[model samples]
Target: MKAVVVEAFGPADQLAVVERPDPEPRHGQVVIAVEAAGVGLVDILQRRGEFGFSEPGFIPGVEVAGRVQKVGEGVDRGLIGQRVFAQGSGGYAEQFVADAAGLVALPDPLSARNAVALGVNALVAHFSLRRAQVRPGEHVLVRGASGGIGLLAVKMALQLGATVTAVTRSTAADRLAELGIQNIVRRDRETEPAGPFDAVIDPVGGAAVPALLGRLAPNGRYVLNGGAAGFPPPEFGMALVQTFFNSLTFSTFSLNSVPAGEAGAAARAIFADAVRGALVPVVGPVFRLTEAAKAHLALEGGDAFGKIVLEP
Candidate 1:
């Protein structure tokens, strides 16, 4: 099997394509012949040794679309040859093993490419929106609205009947407008129609934090998910104190941190939404598996409008 292996964490350039042993299924596990994998900022961070989770020499990918090749003892053999998508690390290879509990059968109408897009970004958006408990007719603001997670957040918020205001530095206002989001704000001018919004979904935190808080209505929920703007992580104690003082709700979310039991249900709901066309998967670019370095570079370059995927 060929894989994108990080020999050491330094930069995207450190990622290399090389032959590696094909993974085999173990107890309660299944081996997938990976067809496609999603690439994102976290992969870049992992390559650069910035991500806090794992160490070096690991295959770095979190979401994949593939077909089951083998199922271990205690796992249903009927899953073999079934198309599926899963969320977890080590998906950047031609073959990888995964816990059977983490796999979801792919809908017949959903292509592998589209499934890759929905894998991480869409699921996170679904979880975040559910956590916010957004109500119809409520005004919701999404920071980094043009990025992978942000774009899905915009679509989901609109689908839930909330009025969405998207914040982006890109000039893709027309694209977002076509998706029924007319309230687009340029990054330079965030103060224009001041909001006492019901909820604010912020992926870019830094100065945007205080600005988002200012726009939130009393008792509004602020969900912090990512920091696309490259800001340092906030001081949680201080932020919590401020939230308490203002009588507001502040919560942080990471799909990587979600418990195993809850994650499956969330992924299922998100996939159903995508299959029903309530959520559209925006695929940016497709690279061959050997081009993993280029994929990571593209993700870190901040020019893509949607998820970048690697075809294995």
Candidate 2:
């Protein structure tokens, strides 16, 4: 099997397409013949040795869509040949193993390619919105509104009957409009409309967090899921103290940390939403599996409006 192996991390050039042994499923796990893999910022970070997963020779992908080739002991035999998507480590390869508890059967209506596009982005959006307890008729503002997670956050908020205000750079205005996002605001002028929003979904933290805090309504929730702007070491003590005094809620989420017992159920719910058209997977570009370097470069370029995928 061919896999993108990172023996050392520094830049995209460090990744090499090399022959590697196919993964063999262990107990409670299944090996997937990978069809498509989701490319995300975390993959880029891992490639650069920033995510701190393990040391060397790591395969960075976290989410993948493929067909089950083999099921290990203690796994159901009926799962063989099933089409599924799973979230785990070492997904950027032609074959990988995933825990049965972490796998979700793909719906007939969703293609393998599209399922990978949904990846962790949609799940994060679902988790973020649920944790925020966003209600119908609430006003929701999504910072980084054109990003992989941000775009899904916008869609899910709208689906829940919230009026969404999507904040992105000026250049993405037309794209947001095409997605039926009417209340689009440029990031440079994000605070101009003056919101006392019921909830704010902020993935691009830094100075933007304080601005988001200022826009929140009383008792409003702010969910921070990512730091697309680069996680500058924040002054959390004083800022958290201020949040406590303001009677507001601040929370952070990582889909990777979702427990095994609940991961499958949550992923199934998200997949159902996608099948029903309540959530759409936005695919930006597709690259061959061997083109991992190019994929990383494109993700770092910062101009992409949707998810990038790698086909195996």
Candidate 3:
């Protein structure tokens, strides 16, 4: 098997492809012949040493889609050859070992690439909106709306019947419009969108926090799901104080807080929606598995419009 290993986190070049012996599944685990792996901002951050979750010699990817090649004890033999997607360690490889219980079977209509693109991203968007308590007939703002999770958040918010205003660079406005998003706010613009929104789904936390919070309407909810740009500036706290009289609600969310059974059910529902074409998968740059460095560079460049995936 070929796998990408983080020899030492610094630059994208640190990711090196090397040959390794194939892995066998342990008890309650299965080996997947990885078809595709999803790449995100976290991968970039981890590679740059900004997120120190893993040490040297670690395989960096987390989400993958493929077919079950083999199963260990306590796993169903019938599962072999079933298409599935899962979130686990060492996904940046041609083959990955994952707990059989964590695998979510992919419907026939969803391709492995699309499944990898939508898996964790859909979970993030779905749970973030739930945390924000987004409802119909309200205006919602989704910052960093051009990235994978951000794009999914925009679509899910629109489906919830909220008037979604996507905040991204001007380059993405036309594409977002094609997705039925009419109210697009350009982050690069000199003028900002006046929101007073019912809720704000922000996946990019940075200096923009204070201004976006100011746009929230009285009693509006704000949920911070990811910090792609880094932590909120010191003024973030002051921004909340300034909006004190608005009686606003602010919270942070992670899939870790949700029970496994509940999240699995939600993921299945999301997959069904994708199968029916209610939720479309947006795949951006596709790179070969061995070109992991190039994929990381593309994501760090921030020019790609959707989920960047690596095909093995």
Candidate 4:
């Protein structure tokens, strides 16, 4: 099998595709013939040692979509040929070992490529909005609204009957419009959106935190899911203080925090929606599995317009 190995944690250059012996499924696990894997900001951060938990010689993918090639003890034999998407480790390779219990069977119409794109990203969006307690007829602003999670966040907000204003780059304006988002705010613009939003879904946490916080309506909810641009500036604390009178709420979410059973149910619902064409996962650049370094570079550099997928 060919797998991307991180010899050291430093930069995208640290990722190299090298040949490795095929892995066998462990008890309760299945070996997936990986068809597509997602490259996310979390992977980039992990590669750069920003997370501080990852060491060298690690495979850096968490979500994958493929067919089950083999199953270990305690797993169903019928699962061998099942098409599914899973959230597990070592996905940036031609094959990945994932727990059979955690695999969500993919609908026949959903391609492996699209499943990988929607898997974790949609889960994040779903859980974030649900936590924010988003209600119909409310107004929501989505920062980084053209990215993988952001795009899904926009759709999810609309499905909840919220009026959505997208904050993204001009390069993604057309795509945002295609999703029927009319109130688009350019991130490059000096001025901020005229917001008083009921909720804000921010994936790009940075200096804009203070300003975005100020735009929130009284009793508004803000959910921070990722920091692709980096963490909020030191002034964010004072920003929170400044918004104190509004009775605002700020939260941070990770899918890891959700119980496995609940997350699995949500993932199954998301897959069903994708099958029904209610949710469309946008795929940005497609790269060969061996080109993991380049894929990481594209994601880290903000050059990715949608969910980046690496195919084996």
Off-target runs (Cα >4 Å) in candidate 3 are: 52-54
TM-score of each: 0.92, 0.94, 0.97, 0.97
By summed lDDT, the worst window of 10 consecutive residues in model 2 runs over 232-241
Evaluate all candidate structures by whole-model CA lDDT and list the values in order: 0.83, 0.85, 0.89, 0.90
The lDDT ranking, best first, is 4, 3, 2, 1
Candidate 1, residues 77-127, lDDT tens digits: the string is 999999998877888999878899888888888899998887788878878
Candidate 2 Cα errors over 4 Å, as ranges: 188-193, 236-240, 243-245
lDDT of 4 by residue, 1-312 (tens): 999988898988889888899999989999999999999988887788887355788888999999999999999999988998998878899999998888899999999999988989999999999989999999999988889999999999999999999988888888789879888988776467878999999899988888888889999999999997889987786777887899989889888899878989999999899988899889999999989999988887776788999999
Look at candidate 4 and tell me the lDDT of residue 117. Answer: 83
* Poorly placed runs, candidate 4 (over 4 Å): none
> Candidate 4, after superposition: displacement of residue 261 in Å?
1.1
- Write one digit per residue (lDDT tens) for candidate 2, span 1-312: 999988798899988988888778899999999999999988888887888666879888999999999999999999999999988888889998899877889998998888977768888888999999999999999988888899999999998999999888888889999988999998665554579898988778776576567678888898989987776346643554676756888888888677866767877888887899877888888999999899888878777888889998
Model 3, span 26-94: residue lDDT tens: 999999999999998777777777775657888888889999999999999999999999888788999
Residue-level lDDT for 5 in candidate 1? 87
